[model samples]
Target chain A: MFDKAYSGKRLDRDDALALFNSDDLFGMGKAASFIAENLHGKKVYYTRNRHINPTNVCVNRCKFCAFSRSAGEDGAYAMTIGEILARLAATSSPFSELHIVGGLHPDWPFSYYLDMISEIKKAYPRIQIKAFTAVEIDHFTKLSGLGLRGTLSELKSRGLDMLPGGGAEIFDSNVRGRLCPEKIPAARWLEVHEAAHTLGIKTNATMLYGHIETYEDRVDHLMALRALQERTGGFQAFIPLSYQPISGAIDVTRYPSGIDDLKTMAVSRLVLDNFPHIKAYWIMLGEKICQTALYFGATDIDGTVVEEKIAHSAGASSAEMLTTGEMINLITKAQKEPVERNATYEEVSI
Target chain B: MRLALHPERVVTFIVDRNINYTNVCVNKCSFCAFYKDEGDEEAYIIDEGVLMEKIRETISLGGTQILMQGGLHPALDLSYYTSMLQKIKKEFTINVHGFSPPEIAYMAAKAGLTVRDTLAALKDAGLDSIPGGGAEILSDRVRSAISPRKINTAAWLQVMREAHLLGMRTTATMMFGTIETPEDIAAHLEAVWRLQAETGGFTAFIPWTFQPGGSPLGRTAGHATAADYLRVLALCRLYLDNVDNIQASWVTQGIKTAQVALRFGANDFGSTMIEENVVKAAGVAFMVTKNDIINAIRSSGFKPAQRDTFYNVLNYF
Candidate 1:
């Protein structure tokens, strides 16, 4: 019951299931907003970060390969370290974060990522680098022939910062086998995040919903992430990524409705109490729905991302860039105070 | 998301008592059951001793204001009202939020004075603020339908306008769910909004449904439901944007609905209401203590703050 959750009691599987099944959508949203307000006051968090995909070339081409390409593909491109640094330098506005996530390039060595982060840190030491996903980390571990812990530590020491929660498509094994057969399994993703948590590196988590996933599958995926968060307390935010059927593999014709997006955000806020933030990624949910999301338990609207490629490649409709003023305007219109945050969820005073 | 445009950090309540000074009436409103005939045995005006004891009780309970309202008694003139307020101010250091516009208008008419003169006299007698009672709907057609003898819409607005010109703040209320239409509601809101825009003296807006069980008018065929109440409440929050606070009528809506109303845009919980008789006379009474209000707000995930009649927060619980 919401009364139980309102009292700060830990919700169980049944409670989450009931909430997902309940018809009182407004009630659930109010309860979630109440909890969110208590945690963050009236402030909605955002980040001024650049989303740089180092390389879109990958070894394995999964069905949902909108952003990834095979080695011989004409559109496949890889940014050299010099190009990456130049791109970062060319941006007119300063950013507090460098969000890097890309394909699992088989030809590139793990040292390439290590050097990229270290070079970025050396040049822009003030910028917090939140790079790589659990899948990408798994790729690095396999490519380097080292244990996951050693690979993560090596990367962390070499200025590889926190993980961005991508590639966490629906964690159900059946759905995983069908959608991303070549990617790492759900357990490996959890294991990589757990290892990262042990190293005191806070990371975000995501769930790909609205395609080929049942309500139970979604609940199960959320519970698994919740269980991990309960142990580590290291997830800085939970993002429920709505699936975009922009590729040839999926058969959906319509995007998730605004109600579905809002419900997903609200449910994630309610289900993941241990996670400090729930983000409404404007790149995926669009601007209107994302603005409405503030009232439905979304504490963070990801940011004024200067150049985001992954979601845009997958048919995201939001602008590729938004000014910090525009982001604040959107939040202010929603009756929330906007707070700029860094990769680790620290409020950026500047 | 932000719950309010202003996004007040804490929800507020007032630990006040509603003190009805007299039940004797001159205007027999059909919707009211509390007022009695002048010669009735139960129709007695509160004496100074009883009034002082009530103020002492309120002060002992940590209350900061006394919400004093009563019927438009036939024999009581303007002097009686002023002397009573002067006596309370001399004896106690509490804020006196007394007299609705209807009572003030009635006294002005009885004393053969203008509304402005009546308000100035009352203000000089330590009447700090006014309550928004008897304002069923600011439409004369609806007012005539509800209770023909009650002051018309113009009289109510004129009294409030005059009071504001005297630098006195007041609250505005609506009693809906009887026989009014959507147009009636809009007109009522427009009048309140326009007045508020001109004077900036309205501190809050409160809406309560008409309870007909114990009324001489008998039970009405229909009334606003809980969902209807929420819709109207949210609409009030949107329409009366200049009004700083919108209260949840917990006295009529019950405590639970009031808790949920915090999300619907009600920032204040109205009052602790150590004693209330107007709504009780209509056959529904919801009792609440200071702790009850505090817990209700806390359970709804808001910081509970105690406030005075003027909307100044006195304490945070």
Candidate 2:
């Protein structure tokens, strides 16, 4: 079974299930790492990027969301275009990508998102503006009565370079129904990514695992993304977001064990073979686990995220941003060469 | 190995009995509760008859080797060990994986022999391979503090290097999680890694946390958590890239944690000890059988293969 994955053969559902259920964790890790090394060598990809969440006011509050706030709440304040520009101006450090995603603010019209991205692009023309998630796009379609195509094309015209993979809680409707009933269904999430792909807009995909999701749910989620990648070949990377249960309706006391985290990382790498990269988003997984993740088939450590708000709001202990030197040290310690990448994964000099 | 080559979905374990010949010793490590003073009622050495009986029992149970490590006994001369090995080899057709670095160094010093000559003599006396022991942490500062009378870091490495040059493959071990920082752990791994790179004689590397149960260092610093164990285990696997096998200590860590260690870079599940005394003295007695290991490896989605003392696969389950 591992020989198949080792020989660059795509794993089927049974193989994935066997891997997920099997305790032969090191074998799975080796296979995943073989694929990773074969594809990227020892190079560990990271982006020089900043996360800009312009607002927190969301209409549909998901149970797993710790960042979203009701309108008029104490922390609920949308950044005006000028304020957003000022925030962007505060960083003197050169960055190559602007990762923008936020709550589905019902009051903000679709033009607001368009103008916000346009203004950022106008200011930083060279920086790739990977803005908005599929759910946010779905919100825009509802708000402006523009279908998915109309909303995505409009955003793309206004300097939206790529879609930041988010709001993909879990693909299993049984799990999603309990955690995020108001959020877009799994079908809508896939359709939105597919629509963006058909328009030739490159996007990343994510699966929020490790909370209220079964192993079968996780397998289903990864398989769906794999199927989508087979169809479009547009997913630049697959980010397995470990669910942070801060301020969520589905309350749990424990985070997933380090074993579970590494298993998920390894399995994702093995399962999502067609995807070019698998990101260990260091914001959710702290620097320690992220460093260890390099061996468990993680090719990308997300980025030097200068001020990420989402994971922090959910009790993540990592700093909002890691210095470039810090990230380099981690990659070097893991015996991986640190590579600075743009939003679309073009290797760039640090 | 799968990482070095293509991925193979097989995990191996050895069926061997760890025969502790004598618990009575001269150098009592602060972390060990297994040793006894010469006058203690519990300080009886294994008579030749009992030793042979244990060997027969091990062979009857389908064990391929006998791992004999013990406290450095002051009264027994080097002949006691050489004759014991000779007698075992003469009587039983079993591989004798005996004598850790500390034991070798102690015996060498007592017998006025150099480390190299000592290893040559032992090899002639049917010592097939060396088990990695007495390496609590290879840093001199940690070694000086915990086991002051035990062999120092250099002496342990010297024993291993001389044995390797003599073409005797040995295992490397680290007993960590006591009064050592991350730097100490890294230093221990680096020492073993450097030696392995040079000689390439290490058959496996095993790292287990210090059990502070009934030791003189009892419960002063809490035992290492499963996370700590796994982190170090993963780091050992990543760092000691030259070592062929990374063994998980199911005795120190329970079977479940050891099972999880398979994914974290443990290829060998270590020995299926018919009897173990050191860790049990530290208050952990996780007895595992042949079937227990086989099922654990198989249920974990790996082919459970049985190996000899030198990691040669005898058969696959």
Candidate 3:
């Protein structure tokens, strides 16, 4: 049944088990490469924009996050529309898109965020505002007492360009329960994103790996996203975030291999064959590894982050503010010419 | 492999742009597939004008920094390094996060200078920070097998030590699961531990597995499993007690395993690297838009924060 469900070409359970159990590292790599070659030719893509975290102050302090804050920490504060626009203006880089996400702020009204996007468009009419995660949308719904589609539509109408994929840690409820008791369940996260996609807003997908989750959970996470993508075809990309166990709930001293940094990237390229782009995300992986990863299957990297916060508070390594040249140098070294992209992935040069 | 995320809570960025200033290298490592020989078609080292043009385009599209790395050629001594860095810095307030330790060691060796002196020279030239590139595996055995021409483990540590000692905090990296053992990995951490204890110089510890694409370590060359990568990544967090940040190696592992890694010991989701190339020459291909990263992180139940080289938080949104 499972084989037929995945199309009549599923690896037998025995085969899957053997692959999982095999101690031969090269053998597994060959299998993955063969699968990737058969599934998708080595084509990859990227974009040029900024990651705007609206707020770090959150109620859900997951076991894996180093970016969360307790309401108001010394380094944690929510961004007002003015502050975001000011930072955006400072770059003066012809960013076609603005990637925005934030914590589940308890105090702010949902309309405030819509206003942020509306004002961004007001200031830079040409820039696309790819903002909000399902979590934020869900929070919006709870706060404003509106349905996901209604909220998403209102935002889109008010200049919210698209949805930036954010809150979807793990699909498995057990894993979700263990990692973040405060976060909306995995099902709800999916439901909200699905609702947004139904409203004609394209979105991305993601999975967090290495922590308490098992291989089955990893496969399940991919399968769920694949199932959803097959249905909606709204997912533009799939990103794999490693569980940041430092200064978070999971103590590395207690459990280390949870940070399966290398495996996550390789498998994501191999498994999410249907997803067009897989991101390396230098902020968490660091710049050098992300550059090195362009070959491993991650073709698109998130842009020149002029200013970032959540990851830093948790202890990410890379510049807080990136300039134009750094982005070009990284792509050039990878031997790939860098192209600018806007929200919805339109190439933007002018 | 996982399902499409219900993009929700985390923070992510976009893609686009790449700029490599120079490939002229005096120190060639076995793992590097990007560097070029003096006269190769891909060998021409980019000059200031060429680099400036590239930067101009990237800037035209919101590029944030230029990762300027080149060879440790004897001809390109302190003046060359400073001049090149200063040129980029002067023209634009770009983050010049360039130069591996081997390049530093080479320049230091050439200029009758210490590592600290070489770093100071570059720092004065507007270099933001150093990348942990040359510290391959922190083990001389792996060092000897791969790039004998490169500096030894001791020298790598010394360079990082000097950089840290001079107050130039940097990241520590390890390229593992290649002709190495758990003991070797542990030993690598021990070395980092000693240095971090003294200087607290490390901003993060990134452990990536080797890619055997076009290098001497071909397709048949050994590579680690996702589990192995996780084991090492998580272990680095556990053992490298001094280091605070443990990034997921999505560059090598792809996104799913990287997501899986978040549970093990990675707190940071890592960079939204707009562009990259070094690993592709070996073999690995994964890509992420800024939104994808945020969704991936948020769905995983963590608040994704966009961070910088100095570990400063930009904004919470």
lDDT of each: 0.83, 0.83, 0.68
- For residues B130-217, write the lDDT of model 2, one tens digit per residue: 9999888998898888888988888899899999999999999999878888999999999998998899999999999888889887
RMSD (Cα, Å) for all candidates, in order, is: 21.5, 12.5, 18.7
What CAPRI-style quality would you assign to candidate 1? incorrect
lDDT of 2 by residue, A282-321 (tens): 8887676676677789999987778887788887767789
Candidate 3 lDDT by residue in tens digits, A1-350: 22222342544334443443443333334444444444444433455577788788887788777777888677678888888888888876666678888888888997798788788888989877888888788888887777777888889888986877677878889988887888888788788878877888888887876667777877777777877887888888777875554545564432223124444555565556566677777776666556655545566677776667766766665567555566666666555567666667666675
Q: Tens-digit lDDT track for model 1 on A283-347?
A: 88766567767878999988778898878888776789878876887788677899998888888
In candidate 3 chain B, where is summed lDDT lowest over 10 consecutive residues? Answer: B1-10
What lDDT score goes with residue B262 in model 1?
73
How far residue A330's Cα lies from its native spot in candidate 1, in Å, is: 1.6
What is the two-chain DockQ of model 1? 0.01
Candidate 3 structure quality by residue, lDDT tens digits, B1-317: 00112123333322223455567665566677766667667776566676676666545544465566666554566887788777777787556667878888988888998888888888888877778888887788878887778999999888888888777878888887567777888898999899889899898888888887777664445545554566577677778776767777666776555765665577666665655443332112223355556656654445677555665555443
By TM-score, the candidates rank as 2, 1, 3
- Chain B TM-score list for all models: 0.94, 0.94, 0.86
Model 2 spans with C-alpha error above 4 angstroms: A245-248, B1-317
The DockQ figures for the candidates are 0.01, 0.04, 0.05
In angstroms, give how far residue A131 of model 2 lies from its true place: 0.7
